[model samples]
Target: MADVEDVQVVVAHQERATVRVGEVFLKIDADQRRTDVEVEAMARAPIPTPQVLWRKPPVLALAGLPGSALGRLGEPPTSSPKAWSAAGAAVRTLHDAAPPPWPGRTLDEVASSLERECTWLLANDVLPADLVTRNRRIAEAALRPWTPVFMHGDLQVAHVFVDGDRVTGVVDWSEAGPGDGLYDLASLTLGHREHLGDVIAGYGAEVEVDVIRAWWSWRSLIAVRWLVEHGFDPAAPGCEVDVLRSQV
Candidate 1:
């Protein structure tokens, strides 16, 4: 093993912290259960994921995957549209695989959470009342029941790595479980609407664009509070707030 000298903070908050040391990543989380789920999900997933190097209570180590992330939130994707489509194809592969043994949030649970988040946003005056209300209504379209599939529950663009037009790997498996496939699609395309058609084309399935749009609203509305609480700026250009405002 190479000596770890260079360390970079990937993310840090009350719940967890992730740092990179050379080619290895060390994730520290107080809850072992989440780490357990992440390890198990990586083992079960059909798509590429970071290899687990080792684990210790409160810390899990993983070898780095090849290539860079697909893109970041609140920024234009540097990857070609073809790369985005490749990522879409990769997601489809994961969805087609056998479902994970664990369950994920049901549509009712999602709706309930959305409602609560909306209430909080309004109470906190996070945005204009009309803006929140309009987006909430749009979110309703995503509340309908869906047949569960193997989902990378947090398929944010930053979690997906690409090499040329091919998807090299996807990181962050703590949120993987049985969930709606569209949720993953929506998450991947959240702030990158221009790539939706390319992604869908590579998905190799008929998907309702309207439903995906609904999920965009649902996801953004629910995520803003969490991002704020966690010290991320969702108001940045091309981020969650902008995504919601773009709906108008």
Candidate 2:
């Protein structure tokens, strides 16, 4: 039903797609799952982000990537620690940019998103029952009361891009919101824990590293659960369900 073409979905999730439109890029949500589009549209001008192309029914296009996600690149940085440090600095800049309340979101909203994933898995008869209890516990621990700040809810390495060891752009804004910034830090830092300490420290929030690690581990577990539910191969990279189960 949509007329846009030359379509290339650079990154995709359960409900949205990132497509190119001429010189710019657009994120088109076929299912109106997140209500923050209009708000983001108004507020993005002040933030250091890609130029938004347009937003109408069934299509919200924005600037296409100036580069690819850093994590997905085949080569590791000459100094991995420095690369992550730069990423933390970048996230801080994006979060500090002024914006209004992103409608239909709160800390509770984040908790609910995790719950819904579990529910979907269970309904599909794919969730391992024992793992379900463990996930619930992790989610409970993560749903703490905290000040709301802009968070890249899905800030994984693959969602980032780099050029000459310098971060060029970050893809995917579907999960952007106000929450714990440390959680976003953890999402990108956990897998590279050895180097992460310096990275988080460079971000100027040494106190939050432990909390960020907890969230980083929690999200890894959730990703495993989602993969199992969707019938994807868990042996693939980033699957942490087996490790999570061992901890139980």
Candidate 3:
């Protein structure tokens, strides 16, 4: 509470906004339940996470991690293969740990949303119908049942932080819970397929890579309209649109 001069707005949407004041990040959320889940999940996760400084209803303060993000959706990774491997290892650790008390999306729920989103895409002509159709077919493989594990339900690459070859911590834990582990894997490597092997190498190779690819399609396909609504460009190079196109 000293003389805080600089205030940086990190991200803002209708649902939430994150502002950074000095080294502390203040997350203002609309839903108290999501914030509750985030705090609890971070406490439960075996892997590194941000330190919770305080919480005041809509605003939660977290101490910033020590490293840059692993990468962004439409950007080339600055972290090395070793760092990506480290991230994968950390994810594996989280998956092996006992899950939280809360629930995550079921397979049926995911499939239903995919169907609705696909219909919206078609109606709006958001993408070429054939492209949508083809990726939808590819995405079908991910619709099957999975053994649940503790999932960082939105494991985007930007949420992971690293320094050199070491994973410093992960952030944005509102979506963490029991869910498909491969979904987490797919999310972390989305738009960054080249690093998948390095991740698998560290994670130990019981994974079905084709399933990972399928989830990639599924995730990208369902995400397009949401991105558009959220003022993000899914069609950006190396982003969600490119990810869907790369299915073949």
Candidate 4:
């Protein structure tokens, strides 16, 4: 093992933080349940994930994946379409497996949170009234019934790693559990609309394009306030705000 001489903060907030030391990542969380879920889900997932180095209460250490992340929110993906498709295929495999024993938020919970976030966004004047309203209407399409499948929960393009056209692994398992499959897909393609067709082509199944678009609106609408509070910029070019605007 390498010595921890140089440390880099991967991500940090009040709730949790992750730092990298050599090839190891130490994730410190405010909540243990999320860590528990992450461990179990990684152990159970059929696809590749970071190797668990060790766990000690608030900290869980994992080995880094071999390649770079699939893409970034505001940047064009340099990876080939085949790599994106491979990511979709890996997600399909994860979805097909049995779900984790713990449950995810129900539809009502999701709807309630969506309503609150939407209200906050409007009240704070975070975006134009028309932009919020149009996207809110589009979001309604995602509120309908959905069959539960094992979901990565936060399938950000940055979370999926790849080498050439091969998907090495996915990281960030704290949000993993049973949920709508399209939510993962929508999350991956949220700010990268041009890659949707490639991902769907890799998905290799019949999925409603409208439903994906709906989730896109719903995801972007609910994420603005949180991103701002967490020191992130959702309004940046090719980010969540742009995703919402594209819906119009």
Whole-model lDDT, candidate 3? Answer: 0.92
Model 2 residue 14 lDDT? 68
Q: Write the per-residue lDDT of candidate 4 for residues 8-28, one digit (tens) a residue.
A: 999998889999988999999
Which pairs clash (backbone N, Cα, C closer than 3 Å) in model 2? 25-62, 25-63, 25-64, 26-61, 26-62, 69-160, 69-161, 70-160, 70-161
- Put down candidate 2 lDDT per residue, 1-248, tens digits, no spaces: 46666666565666666666565766667666453544363356233455555668677666655555555322343446667777777877766665345642566666777777667667766657767666567556667777666676677777766665577767566666666776777677545555576566556655555466557546755576665555555544434554344335
Q: Tally clashing residue pairs in candidate 4.
A: 0
The global Cα lDDT (0 to 1) of model 2 is: 0.61
Per-model clash counts, in order, read 0, 9, 0, 0
Instruction: Give the TM-scores of the predictions, in the order they appear.
Output: 0.97, 0.71, 0.97, 0.97
Give candidate 2's error at residue 10 in angstroms: 2.6
Better of 1 and 2 by lDDT: 1
Query: Which ranges of candidate 3 are over 4 A from the true structure?
Result: 1-4
Say which prediction, candidate 3 or candidate 4, comes out ahead on lDDT: 3
> Candidate 1: where is the Cα deviation over 4 Å?
1-4
lDDT of 1 by residue, 1-248 (tens): 46648889999999999999889999999888889999999999888899999999899999998889999998778999999999989999999999989878887799899999999999999999999999999999998988999999999999999988889899888888999899899999999999999899889999988889999999999999998999998899999899999987
Q: For each candidate, what is the lDDT?
A: 0.92, 0.61, 0.92, 0.91
In order of lDDT, best first, we have 3, 1, 4, 2
Clash count, candidate 3: 0
